[model samples]
Target: MLLKEVRDTLGTEVFSKEVERAIEKKVRLHFGGQEVYVKQSRPDPDERALAIRAEYNMTNRRELMERYGLGRSAFYKIIKGG
Candidate 1:
């Protein structure tokens, strides 16, 4: 499920506490010495656009739309605009 789905299901505060407990339990049992680095930055918009453009040019647009969960006309507009 998506993060939004999880938050909606469990509520934000409960979901966060559950996540913290899960991380602690998992790390304590399996990872004793390692450091976990979770960062705030993952997606880059410029890179994402380049990837979408590349896919639109090289792969099936239908598959791309499915992967993005975008409608045909909307996806086409985005591909053509970029």
Candidate 2:
């Protein structure tokens, strides 16, 4: 999937759960060849820096712009580690 699609999907609460499911499925399929379902919970960052990184990871710059109503320059500033 494209980053844009992933970002849009992540906007929903179900996205987290779906990600968990995908991870569990892959682990089971490749490692043990077992069928198992896992519940995916939202990541809770312990530090502000970690949280900001996580937020960035969750969406691309374009998606972030649409979500936060920001411009490219601001997004670039943020992701630039400045």
Candidate 3:
């Protein structure tokens, strides 16, 4: 089942202590025949910027970094073909 389905059907409490701990550590979970890969809610800034740049001619690095919550060095690295 999708994560949302799992959450809706079982409620957030269905996440056991082990699952919660795994999520905290950003680890995948294998429970009851399901392999759950927990991920961040937001896309990585560099990834988002790359997509935006590809789709649109984004020229403002500062604006893009600020909008995506990226550090200056990381943003530059991503923009510079990292």
How many backbone clashes can be found in candidate 1? 0
In model 1, the Cα lDDT at residue 63 comes to 84
lDDT of 3 at 75: 72
Model 1 lDDT tens row, 14-45: 77866856766776789688886768765575
> Quick one: ranking by TM-score, best first?
1, 3, 2
Candidate models: Cα lDDT each? 0.72, 0.60, 0.64
lDDT of 2 by residue, 16-37 (tens): 6567667667766786855657
The CA-based lDDT of model 2 is what? 0.60
Clash count for each candidate, listed in order shown: 0, 0, 0
Off by over 4 Å in 1: 1-46
Pairs in clash, predicted candidate 3: none
> Which window of ten consecutive residues has the lowest lDDT sum in model 3?
24-33
TM-score of candidate 3 relative to the true fold: 0.38
Model 1 per-residue lDDT at 23: 62
Ranking by lDDT: 1, 3, 2
- Output the TM-score of candidate 1: 0.40
lDDT of 3: 0.64
